[model samples]
Target: MSTDPHANQFGELAWFKSSYSGTSGGDCVEVAATPAAVHVRDSKRPQAASLTISAEQWSAFAAYARQA
Candidate 1:
């Protein structure tokens, strides 16, 4: 956990790509979840900024995406 929320809080987090993402992929996203927040970033740009959301928000998003 970091003192600054805007910072790359857990740069060492173990990021995982979506199962739907192919190795020959064009675009892909990766996610790293923590008890406090879920971090999302583009797999193509591993050094880029990550979008962080609350655990609750991540849960809601996952549910909605599954329905879609």
Candidate 2:
């Protein structure tokens, strides 16, 4: 992550909607990639706050989701 707190530092990340997102356009999460971390936010509110997680942590979370 860069010293800047703004996600804009990521420079136009290719955001992707989660596969589990409902087709009805309900609650959905989106994610974008940075060099060292993944940035996540709600698709309904792109201007809202986002959470940044380390690549390893994101991988662990994905693994846990698959297990569940």
* Per-residue lDDT of candidate 2, residues 16-64 (tens digit): 8968786899988899878789999888888778898999999999999
Q: What's the lDDT for all of these models?
A: 0.81, 0.81
- Tens digits of per-residue lDDT for model 1, 1-68: 65443345445677899777878967888898887998898888877788989999999999999999
Alpha carbon lDDT at 38, candidate 2: 90
Quote the lDDT for 39 in model 2: 91
- In model 2, the runs with Cα more than 4 Å from the true position are 1-10
> lDDT score of model 2?
0.81
TM-score of each: 0.79, 0.77
Least accurate 10 contiguous residues by lDDT in model 1: 2-11
Show the colliding residue pairs in model 1.
Answer: none
